[model samples]
Target: MKRFALIFLFTFLLSPKIYSQRCGGGILTFNIYTLNGEDIKEFDYEIFPVSKELLQKNLYEKVVNEQNMNNSDYPLFKSVETSGRIIGKVFVDQIIDNNNPKLNAKLQELLDTSAITQKGTITSTLLFSTRENQSFPIVLKISNGDREVYILGNYFGNCDREASLVWGDKVLKLE
Candidate 1:
């Protein structure tokens, strides 16, 4: 069942011409910066979901095959490439290490079998924008020389069934 699900998800994500945003809203990818008057990077992002795929079995009966799904599914994001110059000091960062003993133990506690979970691990992303003249947002998680930056907010929604990113208080509805 898990194998079927992984394949279903991969095919949907790798396909082109996917719906560009969540069910009702669109994606917001903007520039990120540091506190010392520097633009860190501009991220290209997207959130979207699967178009319901109908299937046929041995008997040729129509089958609604929803893969390993939860109420809130993760978004299918593809980074856009641009030749525009990034005018800022390069920031060195590290991906969260999965092998750390504490994180390893925490991973188990965070994962749930019955429902899709992301409490312990970095599973979701939030986007934010500030009109103030400040260069950086409020939160930056730096570990092992890597800084994890995100829009800090709490949200609850279904991603296992659709492609979406909560991104602060607003629920971006990808089609």
Candidate 2:
């Protein structure tokens, strides 16, 4: 009985750390961005907290890492951080609109959702964007069965009037 108890205790203690969270295919701990800087104040984009579980199941459109960002050594990123334990990123982009108030409200809503919905697998997620002069956030968070997707901005691509192709207020306007 003593030996069995010791084994059970050891396993219980070891499991959380081992399974708490991890990236898939060595893609853990990375970031994405729109402004191409190291901090949030300089960025014009929002972040998406990706899940390691999504990576494990091979459900992401892109996968990046700290090494990749550092290796490329791009100078314009505004802010960068890991989405979670997996190989995903939450990068600040240039589409943020500082001149609009309604945009602010939508952003607050999106931030609220991202903060509350993050759980295991992260199978579904939302990315947020806002224009400086707009009245509403172009994208919204919704259930798409199993995968989460950003539902605003450009339905096909980054809309210049809605979402800046470049994440900075100074980026060249897409013509």
Candidate 3:
């Protein structure tokens, strides 16, 4: 009994540190806007957290190993600490006459459903933008406390004028 209790306690103590490698458990808000800087839509999402190191590895593989952009050391290939984590905010390209509550509710419903399909504890989102040429047309930056990685890819490929839900590496187009 004593050995079993000790083992259990040890495992419990180390579990969180072991699992701190990925980010999840945060409600991310995406505020959509038009080119003219008018906010049109906003929604929240909860993506199942993935290991930051794993994500960075996957991204590096996607960009360099798979895409064959190995001529030089790609910037995103840097290592993510075991405590790697990220927060998200999204924006879209569209215009609306007004912010409609009914439409917003519908969009929220869609996001809820989408989150149910994928599945953290982060609060308060930040929103900002950079020169179009400096960033991807649709950018999702995952900033670990130490490093910030701008995920490069068309996660919004077919979701133009529509909503997109990113569950880990899977991108779902919500029409």
Best by TM-score: 3
Tens digits of per-residue lDDT, candidate 1, 45-123, equal 2211111121012111221234523312322111111101111112111222334565444333322322323322232
Report how far off residue 164 is in candidate 1 (Å). Answer: 4.1
Query: What's the lDDT for all of these models?
Result: 0.26, 0.30, 0.31
Per-residue lDDT of 15 in model 3: 79
Model 2: per-residue Cα lDDT over 71-129, one tens digit each: 42332121111121111113212223344565455445645533432222222222423
lDDT top scorer: 3
Better of 1 and 2 by lDDT: 2
Per residue, candidate 3 scores C-alpha lDDT tens digits across 1-175 of 9999999999998876553323222222332223344332333323222232343354444445666444334433211111112223221112111245654454344335434321121222322211112211223343224332332232211121222223222232211
Against the hidden reference, what TM-scores do the models get?
Answer: 0.18, 0.18, 0.22
Q: Which ten residues in a row have the lowest lDDT in candidate 1?
A: 77-86
Better of 2 and 3 by lDDT: 3
**Cα RMSD (angstroms) for every candidate in the order listed:** 20.3, 16.7, 16.4
Lowest summed-lDDT stretch of 10 residues in model 3? 78-87
Residue 140 of candidate 2: its Cα lDDT?
23
lDDT of 1 at 68: 20
Model 1 steric clash total: 18
